[model samples]
Target chain A: MSVLLEARGVCRSFGGLDVTRDVNFKLVSGDRVALIGPNGAGKTTLVNLITGDIAPSRGQFWMGDDDITGLSIPERVRRGLVRTFQTTRLFANLTVADNVALAIMQRKRISRRIFSSATELPEVKAEWSEILAHLGLDHLAYRKVIELAYGQQRLIELAIGLALHPKVLLLDEPAAGVPHDEAPKILDAINRLPADIAVLMIEHDMDLVFKFARRVLVLAAGRLIFEGSPADVTADHEVRRAYLGSYADARHSA
Target chain B: MSDITMIHAPQKRVPFAQEAAGALTILALGAVGYFLYPDDLAFLTRLIGIAFLVLSLDLVTGYCGVATLGHAAQFGVGAYAAGIACIRGVTDPVALLGVGLVAGTIMGLISGALITRFRGLPQLVLSIAVGQLVAGLANKLSWLTGGSDGLSGIEPGKVFGVFGFDMYSRTGYLFSLAVLVITFVVLQRFVRSPFGLMCRGIKDDDLRAKMIGVSIYPRLVAMYGVAGAVAGIGGALTAISTGVVGLDSVSFERSAEVLVMLVLGGAGHLWGALAGTVIFMIFEHVVAAANPFHWMTMVGLLLILIVVFAPRGLIAPVMSLWTKMTRKGKAA
Candidate 1:
């Protein structure tokens, strides 16, 4: 698999304090990578840099051969680099199907068609309906997103990401607020994602991380400390000191 | 195929039904006005003209979530363009509207470029400034625009080379009513379009919209241009029907008043814009005539009540009622 996205020594700072320091990584197609870090490890900030939400003070990002450090958020998205929010960020007032349909229309570049209803467009309707149905969200298709439960809304977020047809999908804590029972559904949805897409998920749940990610990258105090298999992450001294403290120790004894 | 997608696709039906309902309401309203205010066709025509302005405002502030207080800038520019075109011998009504539409689009693009760069209160302030700036220029270019005295001496030819624009304003009223209905129908299609849905998405949350891979800035600027085009038509209609373009046409008060009307009727939905215009203008006319000295007080009271009760505007309650009734009927 070829590298689909690469971050080369990326750095960012707010005032005098560094938020992300010299972050570097490569995401190849079909890679399942999880980025784990403590509260201010700049995990989200790093994702922001990659997504062009904020400009990196140093280093560059590339999609294959194209340097994308200066591309706008939407430009990156159009190029198939897409992300989901840690907290669910959806078009709350619009219907679930419309929320997904908007992304599909954008991908198809027909969002500018002003003479026809978006939902009635055969191509757009087909895509959103298939996505919603695939995610088992067909029942919530016509309902306003706000009317759905929090866990359901997160699933909608995933449904939208899939609709964007992303080659590199960045999911920021897809299971953050989900109830325990509802989390497996999120994981199942994530697992069902197209096999060829590279997914970089930031999750605090180690159990989830082990199950979902084949490889994991750990961050501590704005610096990457480890990058390896899920089993290797627990035994890394630096990652253990920085994040997995008690859990790592328990696993070590076991 | 899931039975739900094939069998229960009310989403496909809602826009057409709502659009049909809106068109019929506009026609019914025009008929009522034609019979009840036959002598006041001029006033009715004026109301229809302002309806265009409110609808255009809805496209921007209501749909795009761009807070603008200077929409009159587009309206005024369109009016002046049509008026000047008429004076320069572009006497055809349709041609004059075309002139207004182009002029409004350009003005909308210019203002939208400046306004869409910011968000929240700053956007509102920028819109007001743009409105003031346009009004100020109109005031300064007295030689070209006729300044405070207003641009006059406009004489539009027959609408289609047959129907004369009569002194009683019969042709003008009918022409405006037809245009309003057509514009409403087109706008109904517009707001339900993917472009319209995208704008609604931006309004709800810009970041989410961006992450979806849709560039919203140009979309918003384009939307403003569309809004300007609509407002311009309204402005042109006013110039053609009234046979004049005044400083008030582009004034800050005109912008504020239309915003008030939009809020009163509702902002996001096209119907609210029309409803707001009809209710506010008629209410203003009746109250001002009844208690000219304290008419502002009564208008204020009505606005307060609407805000307290139907915060979404007067149309919200009616729409909910209609939807509820339809669902109940379906259940039955």
Candidate 2:
């Protein structure tokens, strides 16, 4: 598989303490990878670096053949690399449809003429409706984002990422704070996305991670500990020691 | 016709009808004011000019979430530009207006670069500094601006060679009102546009706006330029209407007063600026007729009340009240 995004020797530090140390990673097109790590294992920091939220202390990143290490977050998004925050970041006061519409609007070439009714534009409205429906959020299209439940907000965040029509989606803890029942739904949605779009999910739930991701990368203390198929990673002794411990054993017995 | 089609037809027509009615009422009012209040025309002219000035503040403060107390500096610069132009034998109103807009835009571009670098209280401080600098220049350049004595002998030419703007209140009122109405309509159109949405988005969340690919600085600079032009037009109107320009045009108190007018009506709402200006000026007229000190006290009290009770400014509360009353009447 051709690499869609490649990170070589990615390093970031906060006041002498290394948060992400020489983390080399590659996401090929159509890859569904789960990054699993204990708390403070620098999963978010790595995502931030890849998404251009923060510049790497030292390293290089490429999207396809283009080096994107110095690009801003929005510029990266425009280039088809989009990410969801660990916590949902939404335009709270705007309607759910408006949130998605804004994302669609940014992609358009028109210099937003102030007096023209953007909503009446056929292409813009059609795209907005399509994105809303795809996210199963059409019914709540006009609802304020802040009024939505936590699960709904998560879906809205996913919708925002989807609206960007990204080539690679970096989801920072998609299953975090999701109820058990709703967790499977989110995983199912991610599983059903177009094969051309790569998904790199950071998940703590082993069951969901193993089920959703074909491959898994485990991080411990900001360094890669294991990289293999979900089954192989599940069976690794050090991965068990770092994250699973008795939980992996308990699942095995069950 | 089908019930759905029949029901929706009027829904589409209602906005147009309301707009037509509003236009008629405004025109009627203007006509009545033109004929009946000839004595108070000069004061009315000043009110319209001040309204234009406050509208500039609304563009930055209300729409873009830029808090500036230095807009008066732009007004002062425009006034000085027009006053200087008049002294240099450029008395045509349109030419003076152009000069004011150019001067204001240049100053705005300069100040906007400085202001856009900082936000919140820091932005406010920088704006105040800009205002002080402009006022000091006006004071120091006594020969050009006439310093404390102020620029005099500003003979604005005949309006389209038909009406001469004399010491009489009639011509001044109509000219100022015409400018105010045109500016208001242009601003209304501009604010309701997609560009306005971008500004609103920036105001709502700067970080998110940047994330959405909006370069905040360029947009802010452009907005400042537009705002400066509007303010300059206002300053030109002030110069033409009053036939004089002074350092007080850029005074800190003038900035504060315009800010108060914005806050009083509703900062974000376009019509609110006009409403605030009219209400404020009328209140001043009434209270000053009683006692000048009493008017200031009343205005201060009113501003304090507005800040405490209607933090979103007077529009939101008035709108809520209007909606509630209408709903209640319908229920009854």
Candidate 3:
């Protein structure tokens, strides 16, 4: 598969401490990749570097063939490189639909229209409904995001990310704080995403990473230590020792 | 795919009916003021002009969530632009207003560039700093700006060369009211548009807004420019009608006072600005005259009362009450 998003020799450090160093990876089209590591393994930092939340210390990355090392976060998003927060950041005061509608509007480039009501636009309404329905959140579309459960908010975070029409989506722990029962909602939503877009998820739940990502990359001390299939990741002794800690499921899967 | 039917809420429709009614009320108030208290019309006109400043302040501070108190920088620039134009052989009201608009827009862009780059306390402090800087410059430029003594003798010609700017300020009041209404309507339209929605999103969460692909800085800059132009119109009106532009017009005190009005009215809702300014000004007018010595105390007490009773601003409680009443009417 051809690479859609590539991070080449990406490095980030603060106060002489490296958060990510010489981290290189490629997200090919339709790639379902898992980025897993122990605490402070720089998973989120890598995502931020790609999404332009923070500039890389010394490296260049690419969106397809276009070098986007200097683009702003919004500019990167406009170029189809999108990300979600670990804690699922959202416009808590806005309605679920407004949250989704805004991304769709930005994607459609109609967000700059100074006289057109986005909610009143039939196309916006339809797209909002469609995205909501995809996440099974159509019923709660009008409810303020703060009113929803944390799990549902995560789904909304995903919905907003999906609304960007991303060519590469870097999900930073999409199910981090969600309860076990509610976590399935997120998994269900993720499972339903169209496969044409590349999705790289950083998840602690090994089961979810295994279930969702066909390929897994394990990071340790800001380096890409292991990259293989989910089954291969579980069996890799270095990955288990450095990050996974214990994979009782590894044996069962094998 | 499961069937998903959207539930249309009562407030889903455009607020045309309500806005129209509000516009009518404003027109009615102006008409009544024109007839009933013709002598007091000048004061009212001045309040309406300041209301434009408050309204524009509401846009950047209220809607876009760019914390600013130096908005008077733009207002002062607008006033000086109009005053200077008038002094330099452009006594035409429309033309002077145009100069004010351009000046205000430029000031907004400049100040907005600096202000939008910072957040929280720094933003507020920068706003105050910028406002003070402009006031200082205006005071220093005595020859051009007519400093310390203030810009004077700014005489605007008759309305379309017909109704003269009389001693009673009847033309000024009507003209200010007309400008206020038109600008308010346009602002209403701007806030209701998709770009307006983007501003709201940016206001609620600019970080997430950026992640979702809204160009936060440029949009904010544009909003500031538009808002500055609106405020410029107000500043120009003050210059043209009052025939003076003073350093006091763009002082830190004016900026703080306008911020208070916006907060008093309800920041997010556009009409709340007008409501806050009108209420504040009316209370000031009536109480200051009646009490004279303790008027500041009275205004302070009013501010305290508003904070205690309506933390969201005076407009919020009234709006909620109105919605409750209408919902009850529907159920009944």
Candidate 4:
């Protein structure tokens, strides 16, 4: 498969201590990958490096054939690489429809005209509705984001990322902080995404990783200890010792 | 009609009614001013022009979240540009406004470069410094700027080649009102557009805006420049109506006063700026005339009361309430 994103020799350090030390990964089109780790394993730091929120001390990241190491957050997003945060972030004052519409506007690269009713434009509204439907969030489309429940907000966050028409998506704990019954909604919403867009999910929920991702990469103390399928990871003794411990059975229960 | 048709119909008509209401409100205010106090017409007109400045301030501060307190810099620059143009033989008021627009654009571009580099308190301090710098230069340039006394003998010619600005205050008042209306329409249209929506989103959350592929700095700079034109037009009107450009036009005090008026009316909505200006000016006039010694105290008390009761500005809550009532009515 052709790679859509690559992080080669990536390293991030804060002051004297290293958070990510020479981590490398390649995400190809249509690939389903889960990046799993114990807490404080540099998952968020790595995501920040690839998204250009914080520049890497030493590394090169790529989007398709282009080297995107020097690009800003918006510049990277323009290249069809998008992500969602662990804590859902949205335009709190605006309605859900406006939030998705703004994302659509970004993806289309339309001239943000200063004398037209863009929030209700026919094509933009259509795309917004579709995104809301994909996440089962159409009922709350016209409501302000601040009024929504945490689970609903999480779904809206994913809808916003999808609105960008991303080539490769990095979801930082998509189901984190959501209610028990609402986890399936998040999973189902993620499962409905198009096949051509590769997804890299950073999730603590072992059941979700094993159920959703075809391949898994394990990180412990800023090092990649294992990379394989769910079955291989379950059987690997090092994976059990370093990270999973006794939680491996949770994958089979699903 | 079906339920769907009824629902869609109201949604479609809301914008049309809203647009008409703004224009009609301007006309109503002008008509009321014409008959109510022909003597205070110039003061009333000046208030409207200054309202334009407050509205412009709202664009960045209220919507785009660029905190600033030196907006009067743009206003003063526009006034000086207009005054200089009239001295240089361009006596037409229309041409003078064009000069102010250019001057304001230049001021915005230069200041925006410095101001947009930082945010929150740092941005506010930079803006304040820029204001002081401009005022100091205007005061120091004695020969060109007339120093602290300001530029005098600015003679704006007949507006539209027919309306002569006589001593009676008819032409100047109408001209100011007309400028206010036109700028308000343009701004109202702009803030409701797709670009405006994005700016609001940025105001709500800048980090999220960046992640959504918004090139924020350039958009903010552009908004600042556009806002400059509005503030500049306001300054030009003051120059024309008063027949002199004073250092007070760009004073930090004037900036603070306009900010107060904006916050009083509500900073985010265009209508709130206008409402705040009218209320603030009228109350000040009444209190100063009745009890000159305690007028400032009364005004301070009035502001405290407003802040305590209607913190969102006096206008936004009303607008929101109106929306709520309409929605409830429809549901019933």
Candidate 5:
């Protein structure tokens, strides 16, 4: 599989402290990569850098060979590089369908239409309904997002990401605050995404990371400590010492 | 299967019915105003003009979530543009409105650019500054704008070159009402469109809207321009009806009053703006006439009651009631 996204020497600093120190990684098509890091490891900051939410103090991002270091957030999105928020940032007052429809409309370049009703647009309706259905969220389509349960709201965020037609999707802790029972639903939704897209998920729950990602990149103290398959991740010395000592030992004994 | 089909369900006819109802209400209002306040046509006409200004404010402050207190800048510019055009021999009423529309649009774009750059308190301050600056400029250019005394001698020709603006203010009132209705209809379509939905999204959360690949700054600027156009028409209506343009049109007080009217009626709802304008003006007229000394106290009480009882503005409760009644009817 070809690389869909690449981060070369990505570094960011808050004040004089380096948050992301010389981070490097590649997300190839069909890749399921989980970025595992302890709190304040600059995981979200790295996602922000890639998504153009915050500029990197130093480094470059490549989208399928095109250097997208200076592109605007919307420009990066247009090029099929998208990111979700750590905390679900949705149009809360709008309906679930509207939240999804806005993304689809932007993708279709029809968000600027003044004469046509958004809900009545045949193309937009078809795509949003299909997205919601794929994510098993059709029932919540007309309901305002503010009224939805937290788990369902997470699903809507995924639905929006799907609507953007991203080739490289950066999910910033997609299951952060979800109730235990509803987390599997989110995983199911993630599993159902198109096979051609590359997904980079930032998750703290090791079980979730192992279940969802084939490859794991461990970030510790602003540096990548380990990069390997889940099976090998637990075997790495630095990764164990830095992040997963007890969990890694427990997994090996089990 | 039943669930998926809902997406493909025939386009909801509810909004259309609602639109029809709103249009009829406006027409009915015009008729009632015409007959009930025959002598107060000039005042009624003035209310219609302010109605446009409030609606324009809603587009920016309500829909786009751009807090502005200087919308009167656009209105004043439009009024001055139309008044000056008329004085300079662009005697046609429609042509004068066109001039006002252009002037308002330009002002909207200018203000939108400056305001959209900041958020929260700074945005409000910037808006107030823009309004004050425009008002100051209008005052300073007394030679051109007629300054403190106001610009006079604006003689608007007949509507369609046949129906002259009568001394009894019959034609002026009718013309303003007709234009108001047309503007309302067009705006209804505008606010329901995809663009309008996007603006609503921006209002709800700009960062989410931006992350969804929407270039929010431009959308806001565009909305401001549209708001400007609406306010411009309102200003032009005032200029043509009253045959005078004053600094009060662009003053800080005018902007604050329009904002108050919007909050009173419901910001974000077009009909709310109209209702607010009508209710506030008429209430002011009657109360001030009855107790000119303590009229402010009554208006303050009314505002407090509305805020305490109907925080979403006067229109929201009525809307909910209508929805509840309609839903009950369908269930039965």
Candidate 6:
């Protein structure tokens, strides 16, 4: 399979300390990967660099065959590379439906006229209903985003990403801050996404990662420590010490 | 997608009816003011001009979230352009209108670039600086602007060559009111359009707007141009009505006064600006008539009270009160 996204020797330094050091990463079409790392291990930094949020000191990044190293964030989004933040960034005042509709309306090919009345479009309304129903958010569609629960907000964020119909979706801790019971629903929704859409997620929860991700990449101190199947990753000594720690032993004991 | 699911669409749209009733009320008030207060017709004319000015400020500051304290400079530029055109024998209202729009657009583009580059206090300072610069230019160019004495020979041509602009102030008042209504209607449509929604989105979260494919800089420039054109028309109206153009039109205090009107009425809503202007003019006319300095103190107090009690402006409180009263009546 051809690579959907590739980052080569991506290096970023803040002051004297390296945040992301010579990280070479790739996402194949349909690949589901989890980026696991300790806090301040440059997980978010890597995502930011890939999404063109911040420039790398020295490296090259590409989406499909296009060199997107210098593209603006919006331009990158237009090119089918989209990302969600760790913290849900939603238009809190707008209704849930409007929030999702905004994404569908912003598609590069959509006519400016469509933006004015996207809800009136059959395809747009269908897409909105389908996404909301799939996430069990149909009842809350008309509610303001601020009125929704934290977990519901995360689902809405995912629905917004899904609305973009992105070929590649970068989710920065989609399950973060979600309640224990609601996390499963979000993870299941993510796992069931069509195979044509690639997902690269940063997750702190090991059980959710093991169940959903096909492969895992481990980062420590801004460097990739390991990349392999969940079974191999859990057994790796370095991975054990750096990331899994007691969690790996707990899983083994279970 | 079941046909049986019947989404409860209201039989008659409530907002439309409310809007229609509001329009009727405004027309009735305008009629009353026209008939009952013929001697106070100058106040009504001033109200129209100030309303238009407030609307322009609302476009940039309220709609686009571009903090501008120098819109009066654009208004002044429009006034000067039209005033100069009138002095040079281009007395046709249509021609003067075009001149004002063009001139305002040019100045708006220049100042917009400077203001959009910085944000918050810096943007505010830059706008203030632009207003000061325009005021200074108007002051120094005595040959063109007449300095402190102002330009006096501005005799605007008749509207469409049929109706003459009489000295009774009725023709000018009616003309300005007509212009204000047309401008407001057009702006209302524009504000409710997709472009306007995008601007609101930009104002809410610029980073998100950019991430979603909105180019902020270009949008700001376009909005600035639109606002300048509106302000320019307002300036032209003032020139034609007052029969003169003065340096005070572009002064910082004038710009600040418009900002106050926007804040007092409501920032984002279309009618809020017009309401703010009317309230401001009324307060100034009644209060200032009693004592020259008392008007400023009263305005200051009103602003502080509005900011403290109704940060969303006077409109939101009025809306809440209306809703409560309606609910109470329904219960009764």
Best-matching candidate per DockQ: 1
Model 6 achieves a DockQ score of: 0.34
Chain B alone, TM-score of each model?
A: 0.95, 0.89, 0.93, 0.94, 0.95, 0.90
- Clashes in candidate 5: how many? 0
Worst-scoring 10-residue span by lDDT in model 4 chain B: B1-10
What are the TM-scores, per candidate, against the unseen true structure? 0.95, 0.88, 0.93, 0.95, 0.95, 0.90
Which candidate ranks first by lDDT, i.e. highest?
1
Please write out the lDDT profile of model 3 over residues A108-132, one tens digit for every residue: 9899999755665789888989999
At residue A84, candidate 1 shows an lDDT of: 93
**Residue range B65-113, candidate 6, lDDT tens digits:** 8898888988999999999999999998778877887888888888888
- What lDDT tens digits, residue by residue, belong to model 5 across residues A167-191? 9998988998999998998899889
- lDDT (CA) per prediction: 0.90, 0.79, 0.86, 0.86, 0.89, 0.80
lDDT string for model 6 (A34-105, tens) is 999876679999988988889999999988778899999888888778888789888765567766766777
Q: Write the per-residue lDDT of candidate 4 for residues A1-254, one digit (tens) a residue.
A: 89999989988889988888988889999989999887777888888988999999998998878999999999999998899999988998788888898999878876378886766778888899888987788888777788889999999999999999999899999999999999999999889888999999999999999889999998876777889997798788887776654354445564
Report the lDDT tens digits of candidate 2 across residue range A178-212. Answer: 88788876876687778988899998888888788
* Candidate 2 per-residue C-alpha lDDT over B62-156 given as tens digits, one digit per residue, 9 for 90 to 100: 87999899889888888889988987898888788889989988888888888877899999999999999999999989989999889988988
Give DockQ per model, in order: 0.58, 0.34, 0.51, 0.53, 0.53, 0.34
- Give the candidate order by descending TM-score: 5, 1, 4, 3, 6, 2
Candidate 1: deviation at residue B273, Å? 0.2
Taking all chains together, the TM-score of candidate 2 against the true structure is 0.88
Candidate 3: true interface contacts recovered? 0.74
Clashing pairs in 5: none
Docking category of candidate 2 = acceptable
Clash count of each predicted structure: 1, 4, 0, 0, 0, 0
Error of 3 at A251 (Å): 26
Output the better candidate (1/2) by lDDT.
1
